[model samples]
Target: MHFLRYQWEPYLSYGQLFEFEKNKVVYHQGEAGRGIYYLKNGEIKVTLLSDKGDERIINMVPPGMLFGEHGIHGEPYLTSGTTTCPSLVYYFSDDVIATICRKHPEAAGIYTDSLIYKFRTLAEIIAHLDSPVEQQMAFYLLKLVQENGNASMNQTAFAKYIGTSRITVNKIIQKWKQKGYIELHKREIIIMNFDKIRAIASNPHMD
Candidate 1:
């Protein structure tokens, strides 16, 4: 959960800062990769649009993360990025980023590390595709807590993010509530038994 915070302000001086309202689309799939973005604050959802117009939630980018790196290669963006809340994002043109990296080679490591982390996460997701729903939900809930300090996503959104039906998510959540593993608030879910949740997440086969 720890992120390396590079001294990027000086190198990113040429970058433009833009504020986006909640649910605002920063970029769309198939758009020319103009530049990568640095998220100064707030959350962003990266999604992929299928040929049949089906949209899948890829991952959520938290503050201080670098996204839209596909723009660096000058190809079309494979996924669309949208703000989940009011957000401050810095847009760095591809050429400018290249120049900065050329002049400051160390800066390139930051992006490299970020990209590696993203790829690792994607791999983990793929590996867990056939995992029990409870285990996947537990893992995702822990991830949300780590990133946002709580599980704030609603059941519908949570289900979509985990690639499961809302009914399935609701059933597991209700069971957790009855078992005193979590507490459901008006808008958030609080983990009451972190150890138990972690155990389930790590070993789904355990009772």
Candidate 2:
């Protein structure tokens, strides 16, 4: 999805700036949407809570992206958000956002575009749910590369993101390492052979 490049920070002077450490909860699912969040730096994970009280990672908000946007329409938040790393976020109340949109007008278009981008991403995720794990992993790794320039998630988190076990993710990583497709460091996986990885990612029947 294309990231919108609107100058949101300057307009957010009325908003509050907050610093969050890694793993801090930004908002909980089912909570009244108090405001929207603009990520100035670091990553945030959006998770959905199932009826059974299980949590599933729904999306990752990259730096410069917005989260908790449902509040702008007076809707309760559908998902919980948490910081994946130390982060700086600007929180804009619904009234402030509405006022800004009313005054600037163009800001409304930017918000609409951001919502469109998010829906498109959600559609893609839904479409890929039944695909092979290998293909899903490839798409996920590519997504990570686009967002952070490397696979920044550890095996457990990656497994949760991909709906697999940590052991399975570790085995897959080991296989990729043996094939010289990736290099696993302490907490990151570097793509060593992009073409080969791309090939695997594109081929649904690849073993």
Candidate 3:
């Protein structure tokens, strides 16, 4: 991914930096995009709202991930993005991005890999809808620990990502702790055993 460092620089003409407070809205569903975004710091919630006023947690975007650009060809955004915490993001204008793609072909590959990774994750979440809630929670936590690490996260944030309550998250943590899979300090969760955590996550039980 070191090549990504270079790909972002030459396209500076297409993007600018933006900052937001926690819970700030980045974009709305059905809204026109000024351009796609590259997350630099903090976390973001990507969600879909229903006509009936329901919402679902699609995913959380951390640094080095691309958000928006769902419909690069004049399509409206399908989901709304909001900052889960104080965040810094990079905005790339559509026109400038197009120009960069024309000038630099390698960028296309990087962008495609980012997009495909998101798509694959979404597919996994869809598959989880039918999974036992406990397994879903377990898988979500394991992935987060892998991504952001237990070092920087807390129970509340973990619950949010799994679409559960903090109390429930704590109970799951307790279970894993007794099993010697994780160690929960004041605000951080230290994964004690990755293989055991992965095994727990792979279980289908909803407990």
Candidate 4:
């Protein structure tokens, strides 16, 4: 869920801005996607409810990115989004999108690309759903590091992202620490050996 926001920021002048407090629900899974959202500031955790009723944080939308895009074609949202902290957001209603497309034809291609990105993301998640916990953790940890330079989240939150418990997450973090694969600094998990972590992410090598 990273995007080059500057490309669409000017056009969003036609959209409405909203402010949300920490932990507020932005949108719920299974609900109609009214329009897409662009994060102007703050963090939103985009989580999906698993078949077994567990919440898995799929992506963390940082400032200057769009989310709630799965709402294309009036379809229901495949995931739920909530504010990770007090933040500023923009709500681009369906009408707003069409209006922008009419005036700025290039914007249409970006929207199409967003849909493709969403599909590819869901496919990747499906492929990893049945993997072992460690494999799953490595996968997301690598993803986070790639997205934000480091995993800027606590173990408990990381557990939720991996659809596991905090204790289990802690155990793996400890194991990685023992191997000098990562270091816990405040809330961030800094990867020391990107190759090793990337290797584990690609295959179930942690066992």
Candidate 5:
């Protein structure tokens, strides 16, 4: 949080900002913005749309995490991010960002680190593409369970994260459910078996 405050205080000086409601688009995939975001509250889903109009969730944006970092790449915005709840976002223009970097080179490194980790995650996905969908889904469910504090996990959200449709997720969830591996009620998904799930995720190869 301290790192964010260090990076954020400078942007506040510019005073350009916007707020968004649940499911509202903060920016589209190809729009331009000069500043990064400091998420004060709520959550956002970073996503991309297929040519066929399907949504692919890339990541969940939690509080205190930065988004719209394509400013570093000189693009307007790389992908669209929408809120899951009402959100407060600070928008800083390019001029404002430049001023901040001038004063704090370390802040630039922090931003670069964030982007690099994303790229590394993409690399890992490519390497794991050959893995079975069941393992892939299991791996992702475990991640959500951890990230969301094992709270309610919506099947649609899981499907989006796995880059598949909800129906596919439902089918896979059904298999797990029958095996007493999970419990699903409405939008809630509860993992009942951790060892088996982890073993599936730990498979050295994507079978």
Candidate 6:
């Protein structure tokens, strides 16, 4: 959900603000999460570190979204958050959230919605986990385009996000470009045909 319709900004007034530089590690995985975070500006990438020491990009938090919700209420963070660019973020500790909820009961509902969104993200991850690389790539491409109008991504980041090699991502992107499914430029991908991408994203003929 976009930040405007989500209506969680007012509640963030009680949060502590922090600035982050590009590529900064906001929080590490398995750490006791002090609180949830709201992105006031720039971008944050949430990732999971596998036992094999690979970093898998899971969620990209843009401006005006709540992230790190999975780590609230004394739970350890399930993943790590790092800034993809310079960022302004608001941190809300459990006590702070409790105070807001007590003063404004509606805040609780927003938290619930945020958790629901988190669950949806997790479901998407699981759904794509076993899919072929092309399908996985298409699904995320379509989803990002639908969410942000166009996807600002490089092949390397896309490869890391989808757990593949950069060369593999480049090949698929080139094929899609030839088919007019997308227009690929440096660090950006513009969809030429959403329906066609959506079709391939759902098509699973691989053996």
Q: Could you tell me every candidate's TM-score relative to the true structure?
A: 0.88, 0.89, 0.82, 0.93, 0.77, 0.94
Models sorted by TM-score, best on top: 6, 4, 2, 1, 3, 5
**lDDT assessment of candidate 4:** 0.84
What is the per-residue lDDT of model 5 for residues 1-207, given as tens digits with 9 covering 90 to 100? 224323445445554656788899887887766556766677878876767887767667666667777754357676788898899877766676677778878767777766665566456555555677777777767765765545355777877777777899889888788988888877777888888788778872522
Q: How high is the lDDT of residue 154 in model 5?
A: 79
lDDT of 6 by residue, 73-180 (tens): 788998899999999989999999889999999888888888788778878987788889999998888777666566888888999889999999999999889988
Query: lDDT tens digits, residues 1-207, model 2?
Result: 435632576576767899999999998888888978888988899877768775657677877777877655567787788999999998988788888888889877777787776667667777776777778887888887876567777888887777778898888889889989899889988989888778877885654
Runs in model 1 lying further than 4 Å from the true structure: 5-10, 50-54
Off by over 4 Å in 3: 1-10, 50-54, 150-152, 205-207
Query: Which ranges of candidate 6 are over 4 A from the true structure?
Result: 3-6, 204-207
**Model 4: clashing residue pairs?**
none
TM match of model 1 to true structure: 0.88
Lowest lDDT 10-mer window, candidate 3?
Answer: 1-10
Task: Tell me the TM-score of model 4.
Answer: 0.93
- Which is the better candidate, 1 or 3, if ranked by lDDT? 1
Model 5: lowest-lDDT 10 consecutive positions = 1-10
In model 2, the Cα lDDT at residue 14 comes to 68
Per-residue lDDT tens digits for candidate 1, residues 48-92, read 775777676667887777788776767888788999899999998
Query: What RMSD value applies to candidate 4?
Result: 1.6
How would you encode candidate 4's per-residue C-alpha lDDT over 1-207 as one tens digit per residue? 446544568777988999999999988999988998888889999899978898888888778777898886688999998998999999998989999999999988887776687677778877888888888998888887766556899888988887779999999999999999999899899988988888888777643
Off by over 4 Å in 2: 51-53
lDDT of 2 at 81: 89
Question: Model 1 scores what on Cα lDDT?
Answer: 0.82
What lDDT is obtained when candidate 3 is compared to the true structure?
Answer: 0.72
